[model samples]
Target: MSEEDYRIGLIHATVNSVQPILDAFQVHAPQVTLVNFMDESLIFELNETGTVTKNMARRLLNLVEKAVMSGVDGVLLTCSSFTPVVSEISHLFDVPMLSADVSMLEKAVDMGTRIGVIATVEAAGPTTTALLEKIASKRQKDVTFKTVIIPDAFKALQNGDRTKHDKLIHQKVQELANDCDVILFAQFSMARALETLDMTTTPPILTSPEISVKSIVAKISKKEIVI
Candidate 1:
């Protein structure tokens, strides 16, 4: 039951998120083998319509089923916009299934009442804000979540202008950090820039990839589960 033998599946909305997830695993769980499933079009499709269709939810479940069939020990979903889909399907599989932003979202709410969720896509904002609201309601906590969507940064990253993308995110993070009690980067892709970010100006910024990876690793290791 060595970590090297464990296989974890990562499903991404776009290719941009994979590198950051991989980079995070390299630090936190280097031995866990990764099987990545990327559907870059999913993010674009969701953003265009600003809602998750029935077919889209089915596709998300299908992808997770596909990953389980591939012999993964656990699955970590790296798309924030698919938050609702994840909730429907997580319990469908015996293996641990984690929604990308839940841990960060919970932690943000725990930190304070005023939460700033920064997303580079429109679709991500609604789903994540809704999630935080649900959690807040469950805990009977009065919380206000403000979402800031910056699709320009997302476009820059898609076009290979990472410097522009990171700069754009950093500027927004600084601004959000000043306004809110805690900042949660809403997309998995945004986690890539976390390391290089100068955090002097931001409040405690939380990203999903690292926390998700760590949670998945804990699940697989604790259960020594296999598909």
Candidate 2:
């Protein structure tokens, strides 16, 4: 297939996730076409319930089904909280389906024994840590984690306070820098905090958007849509 023929679908649970991945694709694989599907209600429900309910899982799966039916070459779910559902139902689709943080977590496992996970949402902390542990176990690597959840930062972002959000995340990153082998921003939206960080003085920091975009692009290029 030609470069322009690659039509990837991005399934998002929040508006904040949209631009970071779009920016990533613009930098890394501009030739690929992107289709976005946003359902902000998923985040609202997750925040209210503090967990991924069955209804939430079903809704996410339905979105993926719609994306596949629309003829996308691959589907990338941008919400880290729904990652487990993606793992469970990815095989149902012929196209490659991925959780945004999987690629980043896989890389984190490879990079360090101590991984730091920073998240703006309460639920994302546990979800990301669990996924990281699972990835490390699969790779037979012993790993420990330090996870910090800043719900206030997410609230700030939702209220359109980008400076406060970035500042909060940046502070956490600095605190975790010396303690962990690598630090991971747990959400696509959190990737924006990278702009305020000086990465040279810190442990390697990994974010989902850029790394996930690269992973999907590679899979599409090789015609390997393996989950």
User: What are the lDDT scores of the predictions, listed in order?
Assistant: 0.86, 0.90
Provide the RMSD of all predictions against the true structure, rounded to 1 decimal: 2.0, 1.7
Q: How well is each residue in 1-227 modelled by candidate 1, as lDDT tens digits?
A: 77789899999878888888898899899988999887777888887888988877877888899999999988999888887787788878978888888888888889999999889988888888989999999999999877889999999999999899889888888877767999899988898677779977778889988888888888777776443
| Model 2, C-alpha of 178: deviation from truth (Å) | 1.5
| Candidate 2 per-residue lDDT over residues 1-227, each given as its tens digit | 77678999999999999999999999988989999988899999999998999999888888888899999998999999888998789889888777888888999999999999999888999999998888899999999999999999999999999999999998898899889999999999999988977788789888989899888877776765332
User: Residue 38 CA error for candidate 1 (Å)?
Assistant: 2.0
User: What TM-score would you give candidate 2 relative to the actual structure?
Assistant: 0.95
The list of candidate 2 runs beyond 4 A from truth reads 224-227
